[model samples]
Target chain A: MITKFRGLVVAGAVALALSQPVMAENVEVDPWEGFNRAMFNFNDGLDTYALKPVTKGYKAVMPDMAEEGVHNFFENLADIGTLINNLLQGKFENAGKDFARVSFNSTFGLAGFIDVASPMGIEKHEEDFGQTFGYWGASSGPYVVLPFFGPTTVRDGIGMYPDTLVDPVYHLDDTGARNALYLTRVIDTRAQLLASEKLISGDKYTFIRDAYLQKREFDIADGDVENYDESNF
Target chain B: MLNIIEGEMLMKKSLIALAVAGALTAPMVAQADATLYGSFRVALMSADDQDLDLRDESTRIGIKGDVDLGLEGTKGLFHWEGQLETTDSDAYDAGTGTFAARLAYLGATGDWGTALAGRQYHPHYLWVNIPTDIFNTATSDAGEWAQLGNNQHKRQDNTLAYLTPVMGGFQAALGLVIAGSGDDADDDVDGYNVAAKYSANGLYLAASYGDVDAIDRETWGVAATYDIDALKLVARYEEQENAGVEDEATEVGAIYNFGEGLSAKLRYSNLELNGNDGDQWAAEVEQKLGKGRVYVGYFDYDSDAEALAAKYVDRLAIGYRVDF
Candidate 1:
């Protein structure tokens, strides 16, 4: 089941790449505006009708501590991918600390149900193939909204393919169990974001697009962007 | 098991290693600099003709972050805060044992400074109350905000606020609120606040206007402050109007920093509430103590309002606050 989804992601990325030049020429970097807009609307509809309602119900029914533990458990699973990407990006020291963090937490923290890593002087560093690509000087190409995944650029979209291969979820053999875990992770992450939705203004599409691009840049540079100008804020 | 030893070892070694790593890390810019932050504050108060009591003085916690935009200097901003009632003697009445949204807003910033839509503090109230608000309890210029419709527009729901880029030494802000509580047309921009503030080389100046459409009242104020090394001086004047009635106020104060986290200040404020006049005088001292401040102060209030003609009062308070 995991292999099937991975193949689909790769094929979609390849198809998008094959039709790129002519489609993207007129626009600075986003030639797929029409398709992207449609996808954005689709994703928004899903969130409004399915994900949001489920998240609200989940929060209402579960205690904050329990919800937080679920989030931590999934984040611990993500640390493996982060460690791999850190090493790929030549951030050896960060990778080392993160490795220790995961080991310590998984063993004593009951598989990351509790975050014992942070207080142990180990900080979390979220790394992915997308960031690794950006570190190696890959251009972001154009913006694209995935069906259910939401926002991503061409490079990041491709990066997701590689990340899925390394994700523990992809290796889980039981289809139903794996999908349940995946769904829970998605809902948990979305639930955390639900509270911050009140601050949006103007068009949600433009606001999210701009924010996603900027956040990607910040993360890729590991928050060390030399060209940053603070006075703008 | 071996894991237990590893956990204990990591804990013991991390304390020193983390401290050294913390010391070595260079100071970074403010955006997304820290996570999981909150503050704890508790205070004790004794008022004239009232017993001493320990109180919760508006404790708050929040989650906030900013993301840079790849365009011409723009950043996405978000903040969601909650106020909690933690003490038996809560200063705010109707205390409930739960966290309630004190502020929730989302917006963006660029060369235009910042603009947000949602629930947030009014810029007018912020600027006009800057100097006076330094006192932990004084929220804004004059206490008793709801007096004759002179309420400070602290935080209003359904507000669209903007702050202009600081140029030279000037920054300006505006807030427009649509109550969203009533369907009446008068509800739009019913609680608007606007202000302009300037600061440079130890000098600060501000002027603001606030209107409560629902109550048909308007407030305007101007204030200035000058800091000369350890000594600071402030003066302000404000006016309120409702129907045909009017009230005016003036305040002057001085604060002296004794260095090494210690400071002392005194202020006197006088207000003419319609036909009644009243005055409040206060003195305070503060000391900083690691992510927190501890302070004690005294205030004496005398009024000529018919209901309180024989109820002159004095209050003494000691408090401590810490943020993580």
Candidate 2:
């Protein structure tokens, strides 16, 4: 019985691996976009309730230094992000875009580096390991809410490895500060997205749901209009 | 005879398992022929008070492959690697044996990026292993990675890693190393590391940070190399801190190719370990000969002079290395 069970386990793993190719080929719109929309709202809540006040408090303590550090940290972190995106896409030239993002965002975006996406004319692209897994044809397993990382799927959860591997902040040496900074980045990003609420009409859940799916579609295509297949997405 | 039959059965089962794993991973990187490859080295040396004789480098091999799953062109990846050392080798003697370095895992890729799970490299030492002799040295190897006190598993078990798609030469990766230790004290014992790198022509730059539990460690380095015909120049700097002690290390080197299976290189590296106020310098040169390479290296410690010298530690070594 034990031998049979062991054999079954191995067989199951192999079957699962083999089936992935087929599963990925049949693309379907994820209904869980609504669920993710809720996360967006929750993330917005944290930004409004927690991050904003904290930033204000920190600013009160040492406004200039804190603001400068925050600005530098974001630029450095964004550079890291841009570099990783370039490596994954095999576009060396586009990677240089981060420096442009950092320079203009710091100088013109007002110390807040506030949503420099529009003024600098750099389109915001959101991607995580899950999307990469999707590109690689990995089935988007069930959605999950990581304790701290927010909304994720099994495939994306796994993709996190190489994601952070290419993130500079991940390699920082200060534990407390690193955690605070990481949490802050997530919160700040969420806060920035809060403004998009103005763009959406109708149920909050539907608005975010449509937005996330549409945004994911754009990111996976690497912003290439030729790669865009709206019908399938 | 029954015992022999049982052993044979076990061997067959293991082989079958390995074959299945290979098939699953073959498709992921099948396009680039870009494989996942790394090596592990472990050794034991008995340094004499006068001669300072060291031990040979222990080594292991790894290979990885990626396959594009047809579903939306998502991909699957698998890697198998392990250390080959006395303790973990099949030829282990009767006394003591232990597991050292061995990593195996499977993962998938999609529009979001890539994800992986199982035993794998930690982001903490990613950049540290990129340059110089710091990682491969027989004296003070990069194995100090696990020594950092905190909640990080360094190279961990039951891990999940994610990588973002590269956009305009930029990308990011994040990992959550799960500590299976059920104890409450170890609950926060998870390890996380992230890194980002940019490469264009000869200029390559990267920075990374890794946190294992509460102890945060980082490596921020910049390296640039330029090749003009047969000659090339290389320079790099790395900074690291553990338990609040900081070490700043830098390396500069150059290599020249002399046609027909021949090349030469000379490089210097300095490490100031944790404000002990002591600094160490290592210089090395290598010449290619046929399928093998001959190398000469010198290591010197400027701080603990008499004590270090008495150990016959500061000296030069000439050796040969060949890769298969």
Candidate 3:
């Protein structure tokens, strides 16, 4: 009886050991090589119009603190963005936007009212698709400019489905309302990126596009930024 | 995992033996009696590739039960239960005697409801069950939704829990668990947590708050449940903070009972990290077969903010799991 019980226990243990399973998680996005810059411009224009007013209002309200806090939030959020970019491209690209995204989200998402990350006493972060892809072992295929969504890769495009699905705006049933909210979120996010506009002194669109691709590449190769071009754009 | 299971199994066997003995003597005795009981489970899984070297981690056995304190007029009470693991999985049974039993307590039922002491699961676990949209051998529920700090809010040690007697289709509970403060100069007794829950038929809801003394690690969560015919739906929200860092996670899930010992489920999880405000999301599914279950899972994280970033983890597998 003792031996039989031990055998039963051992059999159970081995069975449990064999049942654990592992699966792969990786996505690759092919670059969209042509057309659609107009679409990006339209989205950018809307973002600019919406954010400009909010930024001005913020400036007028608590100018000093907002400015400093916004700066800090952006800097903090950039860590992840930079990490992502570094994962995509050996050298971090779109450093400005990467920094801005974190700052913008922090102020609005947590502080409740875009205190620009100050009132919340929080910092901004930086994380990009490249780093995200690197972590999942996904490949950054060709770059593509999505119509209203802007720059993306095939893998990133597929990824956008879940991303949007989780966004509060998409969960809304009213199409008009959802669009409005999405536009607002976009504008709010972009507004924080305004500071980056001054950093790039070239054809802004091409600079962003190339930088985006470089960043994606870095992600595909896990931050090995040495293989790409840095001066063409 | 294995050690916890062995302990659980031992506890269960002892409890069951006690229960059977009591049951056999119930009619002949005029006096009240107490008893105990529990369960054990084990499974096996395999893959073709040698390089994969994948091992089943969810397989395990356990036991649980309670001793009855006989009394009259709904006064005397007794109860206890536990789920243990018997494998060296990353959780529960980490071999070498460490065990991760879900409930290890003795509680009593009477006019005051149920009062339990010892290691017990937080009420929030009820919510965690709702998000397992997909049932797979491996689950990240605890790490994704259970904790209040870097720590999870699920199975807690040294806890005191009180569950009010069911009244008007409603039942509730409050739990206080021990936590360690991060300060080196201080002992591990960080603070305590308070949690409450209510359940009415197939509908359930709960809320909890945790405070960790020296640090600003505090949390609040809410969960709700509703069943549609044979299908059960669940939703949950948890918000937490640690001084400068804030984290929030939400989940929606459903379990469909096909009747006759068969079921299917799916769950989704979204976690938002606030210091930088990044969020992560996951979805999974599972199916029940006689004495066994099969499952799959997928997860992703992303951030448009500098602080929050997104990544993905996908899994697909099949295995036969059983409990005895």
Error of 1 at B115 (Å): 1.2
- B101-164: candidate 3 lDDT, tens digit per residue: 5456666667878777776665555333333223444434222432233245565667677777
Candidate 2 residue A172 Cα shift, in angstroms, is 53
Ranking of candidates on lDDT, top first: 1, 2, 3
Q: Ranking under TM-score, best-scoring first?
A: 1, 3, 2
Cα TM-score of candidate 1? 0.50
lDDT (tens digit, per residue) of candidate 2 on A86-157? 556665334434433443344335443464433434433444555656666666565544444655556767
CAPRI tier of model 2: incorrect
Q: lDDT tens string, model 1, B60-138? A: 8888888766777898888888876668534345545446777889999998799999888777557776554546653
- What lDDT does model 1 reach? 0.76
Give the per-residue lDDT of model 1 (tens digit) for A1-233: 99999999999999999878645553765668789889999999999999999999999999999999999998998999999999999986577556655655665466789986676446799999989999999999888989999999999999999999989989999999999999999999999898777877898887788778888999998887777876856
Q: What is the lDDT of residue B94 in candidate 1?
A: 54
lDDT of 2 by residue, B160-226 (tens): 8887887666667777767633323545545666777665565545556665553455444444565
After the best TM-score superposition of candidate 2, give how far the Cα of residue B114 lies from its true spot, in angstroms: 2.4
